[model samples]
Target: MINQLSWKVGGQQGEGIESTGEIFSIALNRLGYYLYGYRHFSSRIKGGHTNNKIRVSTTQTLSVSDDLDILVAFDQETIDVNYKELHDKGIIIADAKFNPQRPEDTNAKLYAVPFTDIATELGTSLMKNMVAVGASCAVLNLDIEVFKDVVQEIFGRKGEQVVQKNMDAIKAGYDYMKEELGDQVGAMQLEKGDGKKRLFMIGNDAIALGALAGGCRFMAAYPITPASEIMEYLIKKLPTVGGTVIQTEDEIAACTMAIGANYGGIRAMTASAGPGLSLKMEAIGLAGITETPVVIVDTQRGGPSTGLPTKQEQSDLMAMIYGTHGEIPKIVMAPSTVEEAFYDAAEAFNLAEEYQCPVILLTDLQLSLGKQTVEPLDYSKVEIRRGKLVTEDLPATDSYFKRYEVTEDGISPRVIPGMKGGIHHVTGVEHDETGKPSESAANRIAQMDKRMRKIKNVRFKTPVHKNVKHEQADLLIVGFNSTRGVIEEAMTRLEQDGIKVNHAHVRLIHPFPTNEMLPLIQSAKKVVVVENNATGQLANIMKMNVGHIDKIKSILKYDGNPFLPHEIHSQCKELF
Candidate 1:
């Protein structure tokens, strides 16, 4: 019995390839199988190669496998580009119309089927994806009732006749596969689990839900790839909760609008990728100087300047942490899992409000766009904490309130706009206690210290070190963001091979967590920083925080793909 397997579908853009993978994954998830899915596509909309890969396992998996166990190819180009990634005994289901041939070097088997022809005969060519799904289910010996139920839910709104026709197409595909291939196709049967339900979502959806759960009432954004889905999701769901979403003219407008909404006493956020973040930098600096608490999500993509818009990278580490002009104490939080992405979003608002400073949530395309089977988040545990909010009645005064008042912890009680005794200056320029422009040297030093001091006072309890191995590890691996899963998996495999390796994953990037990280790195015999950027951005940040920069080795990947666990293991093997 197969405990795990990987299935993939490849075809031209807009051909329902994604839908096919989704249907298969949902059915597998219903049977309590863990899933990790990824998609590869181009910048163009149509007539280009696109594929969806889903890995199913009885055990929890968050990273993609290096080889495919089954591949469904819609065209000859699909086989040409993908056959090398298939395992030795892998099976390829190709469309008979394409007449696909296996590569000369591979030992995998290829079976041709009339996927499109059968669907067209059933009244709609769109059912072709369902046909592929049905054939795959037959091959895996999966109960067809689950697939039929999912189809009914998805297509029931269209009409009864449409749903019936699709069901006929599924039967045709399944019968064809069974009759032609016989017992050979049913050789690999996946073992079923305890059938406990789990939530399946991408990181963006989790963040959007977390925002709603955290009481975020406003969002403004200019649409951009990868990051646009966060805004799009909020647009549909926010109105139901009495929240508002606006598509601003540009990223600058988005950032400023979110800041303005926050000034009016609401939790507001804006999201964008690398290019949009660059446009929002000046506005972010304004939020910093004015001490407006707002959350900005940077769903990072490959870039020097729109470098690879749809690709994944952890390259924004330096840009997110140090990109803004002038000195500002901003918090940067990176969530490693889809579930963590939700909690991180909720915590981001709390941190921003507590310190009255902007918080940047740094996420990569892999974590932002990739789908995973995550456990349901406990909403009761989600604490809504708005720090330093003064709700008591303060009598109106002619002199404006002390908005930026320097106190013991450098955090002054904050009042919203139009509130009594709360009308104060809101500007990009540095201001004094009464919220007026000031050039006094003492005033400048005191204000700077006050704003800077709030970083440590953040209510967010950040872990300085995690995933540390006991019994004196042989090496230490340090990474952030999407690399967490693969790095942790690699550490496990290395341990099995008698290598004692520990890992330190930093959730809070800004204050750098110097005290907790310094001793860990100092004690390790060897240290490696794995990130997606070409230059070792995380390593440099570690150097700046701790003095032993030279001791840290850097393993980086910038080719717009995430690191596979085996790749991490192979790279670490060379180090030994």
Candidate 2:
């Protein structure tokens, strides 16, 4: 009676894994099952050990389970590296061409299917992935028609002969498995899910979609790992919508171009990982100083150098929040899920245009690379807010536009190029209200004051922290970015043990949600600030908001991996 199952496939890189996992996940999605899929790979192109873990569940899943119910091994290293994580009663399906190391005298069942052999007989060994996928579905009691349909759609371009060969490979693998491993693995399958279809995609895809919905018509970025999907998606869809995605010479050119487009008055953005982000800092400051509205998506990964490019980490909090030279009022935000990634990205444009400052939308490897199920986004919720822009004809006056006008709210009306009576100068250098270079003491004071004074007046929603319990909580766990799923799961386990616990996740990283977070931290008897960084960056941000930050404890992990729910549960258990 397995209500939910965690299935995984391990093989060498460049072995058609991406397509295999994608096909399986899509079929599962059609059957009304939700999947949270994560890819573990190396920085190299091929011949490296890689794996995809797909958590298939009747209920929506956000985190991978600690153990695997089905381990499909393509080679011996796949078995050697992951045997311990297999459930005692789980079954392993190995390709007969490779002798995968089996658990010694263990109850976990192991069956070898001739994946490559069967595929080769059908004219190509490349169909080995299809054979394995078929065996995986057959053992789980899923209908083969679903797999067949996806195969035809994927391989139909090659003509009927090629499609039929793949069909034979799939059917052969399924029949072989059912004939040999009869009720052993099939025991895990339950009734079909509700048949309610849902969209299944990775985080990068959502971010690109969000950019489109956010009215971002221009993008200039140098592709980087884990974050490149956003650029790839935009490259495909942007031009059809009368937009543009320019692959620049480097991050410097990318950021500068985005700033130039924004200055010309269009929603524009550039995305990058750590190294590229470091290169764009100067331009980010330029956007800040010039008060240009632009968004920068930093899909974070292990850092300092070229640290684990394929791994997940929340190590960019301090870097993004405090980056750039001198002083610039900036808004930093982190989205906790795929759904939030879309909306937060849209709001990022709104905030940037409204505040006339650069906005950094932060995401870790987990939230950027991991694929998961998200409810359909309501595009109606997407309302474009182009802030303080003067598009109408201003009575042809001799006065130049005060693009940097000092006001009660620090925001000034912006006009694009060629606007009559709106011609003004703008530069990275310090400037006055009329965009003229100014070095006088009074002007400097007034300009700096105007730029920095908007912190209090920047209007955004309250409770940026997702509070598990709004009332007095026993223990308050504060985390940001990708830690939301695990924290939510951990809180449920803690309450099951009769311990009243509360969790708060901060989505908006800058302007530090002080008024909203003060009461939550104060009410909790014990507060734990959980993050993936070493210094607990969230804790530092909290100290600036609520005094006596030492009252909150820290649970941190920086090992190039995300926190699992059981890991967080164990960490919280120690506090009691």
Candidate 3:
């Protein structure tokens, strides 16, 4: 029996390809198998090729498998597009309608089942996805009953008859496949899992949940690809806690509205992808100068303009760091995993309030949208620390409340509007301690220095996550965001091949974490920064901050796809 296997479902964009893969993976996840899933689709709403590839393992895995074991297809285009990723022993289950053809170049097996015919006979043709899921179950020798929970949850509201029809489709497909393959049906059975409970969700789900737990009472955002889910999730759950979400007319309105909420004493946030982030930059700079605490999530997608909206790319690294005109202090954080996304998203509010500036939570398209099995998040770990926020009534003085006072640590006492004796000017222009606009050079210098110095003692858990196997290593693989898993998998393979490899994933991006990363770079004979950008932005950031430019190299991919383990491993091997 195999310990792990890769399964994929492909079809037209609006054809329920995603639902089929979701049902299959969720049932397996219920059995406690660790799963990682990635989706490839077009930017439009429908009519393009789309697919969901899932890697299921007895042990935990981070990235998509390098090769596919089974391909479930609705049409020949699915096979024509994705056949090359299959191994020689791979299997393809397709609908008999298309009379699918297997290319002569590959030895992978093909089975044409009557998916549409069976689903139509059961009541609706839409249940073809359920039929496909059952055929997959037969090939893996998995019990069809494992899908009961998911099926009930999805179709139970439609009434008992609808639910039974879907179940019948699955049973019919499974029995048909089992009868044809006979004993061979169990050939690809996966090893049994530990049967532990876990959460199967995407990074956006984690971020939204974390935001709610962190006391974020208001979210104002315009919907955008990848980032829209954060807003969508909050729309449903925020009201349970007396919070709310606003889908503003534009990104500018979203950012400004969130700023207005924070100014009124609520923990407010906004989220968007690259294009929206671009539109929100001026407003972000406004938050910086006004010293308003706001958390913004930048889900990085492929971009310059609207380039590859549904693809993966980290080209926003430099923009996030220095996007706004004329420097004002800001914090940018990158969370490499879904768990970190949750925790970091929660902590972002604290950081924004403590530092009295805008905090950006950064994520690539892959990490933002990829679905995976996650351990139960501990709500006890989420702590809300609104720094220097003066909740108590201020003294009954007539003077402005020294809102932007230049203290030793640069963080001044903060109070919301209408607080007793808390009246002060607020604007984007240069301002003095009382927040009034000022043209004096001395006052300008002081306020600017204070804003910049607030981050000098930034509070963060870990700036860089290190998986070090050697004190001194032949190679150091450095990355940020979603590259963490793929790098870990590559590190394991390289270590087994006798290459001393270490990993450093930057969790905090703005402050650069030079002190933590410098030693690792110095110890290794060579350093390669792997990022999903054309120009190797992360490498340049390291070189500029940590130095050792000669030893630093970059492995870059901007092809709108995430790096696979084999791709990373082979590239690092070549460095030897």
Candidate with top TM-score is 3
Candidate 3 residue pairs in backbone clash: none
lDDT ranking, best first = 3, 1, 2
Once superposed on the true structure, which residue ranges of model 1 sit more than 4 Å away at CA? Answer: 462-465
Write one digit per residue (lDDT tens) for candidate 2, span 455-514.
666676543656556477778888887788788888889888777788788877888888
**Sorted by TM-score, highest first, which candidate order results?**
3, 1, 2
* Model 2 root mean square deviation, Cα atoms: 1.5
- Tell me, by lDDT, which candidate is best: 3
* Model 2: residue 219 alpha-carbon error in angstroms: 0.5
For each candidate, what is the lDDT?
0.87, 0.85, 0.93
C-alpha displacement of 31 in model 3, angstroms? 0.6
Estimate candidate 2's alpha-carbon lDDT, on a 0 to 1 scale.
0.85
Q: Tens digits of per-residue lDDT for model 3 on 77-128? A: 9999999999989999999988999989989999999999999888889999
